[model samples]
Target: MIIALTATTQLGGIAWLIGRPFRQSLLVSLASYAVLSISAIWVAPAFGRTPLSCVPEKGGAHAGIIFCVTNRHYVTPELKSALNDIVDDLNTSFPGIQLGVLDASFPFLNDFPMLPHLSHNDGRKADLAFFYKDSDGRPLPGGTLRSPIGYFAYETGRSACPATRFDLHWDLNWLQRVWSKHELDIDRTSKLIEAATANPRIRKVFLEPHLQKRLDVNHPKVRFQGCYAARHDDHIHLQL
Candidate 1:
């Protein structure tokens, strides 16, 4: 288009200098197309590009650096519908609050544990982390990475990923604690919990009961963190 404009609209006689037709001029400027396309993609976000993605297909782009998805688990059509709706709401309602989905299920089209999860055998389960805020009451850092189960909670703008996981010991896993109070940005976690519960299809939300008490989250949708299996401190288990 640029070439066509430059070769014709700007100077009609200029077409003869390159080659008669606009098509010929376009071919001559093929290299320009590559450069412009690359530049456009790079610059689009700065201008006003809202990035969206689906795991196993388009999962790289993120709304904010706030969260990282640990695994590219497959999702059911129903689960995907719920996920999209929740994300759409969160994106619009809480513009800067980026939700990180750690795991779902596989595309097997049936129920089964996706490893470490006793349940989730079906497509009705999804995992997302609590949104954190800095001490000064700012949105938590976006670069938190998802782990095998829970999420990595780190202080913003630092190389520290202070969050820890279960012990490698065979029996110690069940006795493990999810997170310490100092490691989390508690202010924003409440909002993330409410958002997960906001969805109508959400049947249950699993998190540490003590947290539920600490935040005074009276929502009936929130349930006790789990049994002797995995502690639900680092992440929220949203199930339909």
Candidate 2:
């Protein structure tokens, strides 16, 4: 009876989270943590949980040949749809190119779990690695930190603005923490950002303001969130 009651409570909490606004999910997340501490009924989180629902089977790579990075792999249905359609569009814009998903969707039933991110609580955002190219300037293939060894970074002392210095000296601390490589192909990166902004479904893009100026991304949807988080010099974050 006790175990059954706990499971029922967990299910109800999850249902409340899914039906309510995103902001309200924080309460459910906190409650889940508390329950996990006390109840033998608690189980490890489901891999396929999104803000909408926890479908353990729907998480991860799914039917598509999409490459996902890290545990932040729970993909939302809407994001999945957009990605499937945009793959060909990105390929057409830059031939021989594929995408690297840094983060997407969220873990099952825990919208407010303790994560490094601030807004990834719901299944509405995705972060992608910048398109890379070889030294010869040809579009390169997508790779993880291990497979192809894509390493790129910025040197310090560059002037992004007169008042403030740029976040240079490519620090691998974040990458090391997440086990991601910093191999960004700058030229193609810019083009990829441009191509991404062309999609109407991609609501907004977060990039370095100066980098935006350098790329000349005149799209209204492209925005610079300042250097509060690391500069957008390394990856492109897309919101749908």
* Top-TM-score structure, candidate number: 2
TM-score of 2: 0.56
| TM of each candidate vs. truth | 0.54, 0.56
Candidate 2 RMSD computed on C-alpha atoms after optimal superposition onto the true structure: 11.0
Best by lDDT: 2
Model 2, runs deviating above 4 Å? 1-70, 136-138, 144-187
Cα distance off (Å), candidate 2, residue 104: 1.7
On residues 1-240, what C-alpha lDDT tens digit does candidate 2 reach at each position?
323322323333443444356676767655654454333112222433332111212122221122121234555667666655566665565555555665554344546442334556565677666555555655555533222322234222232433333443234544544433334466666666766687777898987666676667778888765543444555567888
Candidate 2 whole-model C-alpha lDDT, 0 to 1 = 0.50
Each model's lDDT: 0.49, 0.50
Note the residue pairs that clash in candidate 1: 65-142, 65-143, 66-142, 111-121, 111-122, 112-121
